[model samples]
Target: MSSNRKTLWQIFRAPLLLGLLSLTGLIGALVGDGLFDLISWATLGSALAVIAWYWAKPTV
Candidate 1:
């Protein structure tokens, strides 16, 4: 196999993490107020930041 080929973990890791983070944010926002509200916003905002970073990145 070529060294350039990505492992399954490498391919799936980011997407899996983003999905879990997004789920946590949604649930947090739904289940409480005050501190939970802040936690949910931070979690969700980080996810959005990651997305924006990817969207604005320069392509090879």
Candidate 2:
């Protein structure tokens, strides 16, 4: 991949994944499936992890 593409991905990765996982969790909750519940929880954890990672970073 080109450097610019890589930079964009790095910049957007967490927010993109967070949005996707949150959407998936919302859909799973609406559908009321046990499997999806588990998936949602896992995604939720990872989403929190991403938030924590960014939050802990020192500002430039």
Candidate 3:
């Protein structure tokens, strides 16, 4: 693969994985009688922060 493709993958990997994991956790929280509300909110907030950081400092 081209270096550009590799770079793109690297750039997106973390956020994508985090997002997926967060979604899974949110779903789990919704189904179970745990602290789903807090967990989901916190996870969403952190994910938004990550996205903002990436948007502010995007690498070529």
Best by the lDDT measure: 1
The residue pairs that clash in candidate 1, if any, are none
Locate the minimum summed-lDDT window of 10 residues in model 1: 1-10
TM-score of each: 0.80, 0.58, 0.49
Clashes of each: 0, 0, 0
lDDT of each: 0.87, 0.79, 0.75
Question: Candidate 2, overall lDDT?
Answer: 0.79
Evaluated at residue 23, the lDDT of candidate 3 is: 89
Per-residue accuracy of model 2 over 1-60 as CA lDDT, tens digit each: 255545788888878978998888777766877888888787777878877988998876
- lDDT string, candidate 3, 1-60, tens digits: 255546678888987988886886678667766577667777767777877987999586
- The TM-score of candidate 2 is 0.58
Q: What is the lDDT of residue 7 in candidate 1?
A: 85
Candidate 3: list runs displaced more than 4 Å. Answer: 1-12, 32-34, 58-60
Model 1, 1-60: lDDT tens digits are: 356989899999998988888788899988999999998898878888998998999976
Arranged by TM-score, best first = 1, 2, 3
Q: Is candidate 2 or candidate 3 better by TM-score?
A: 2
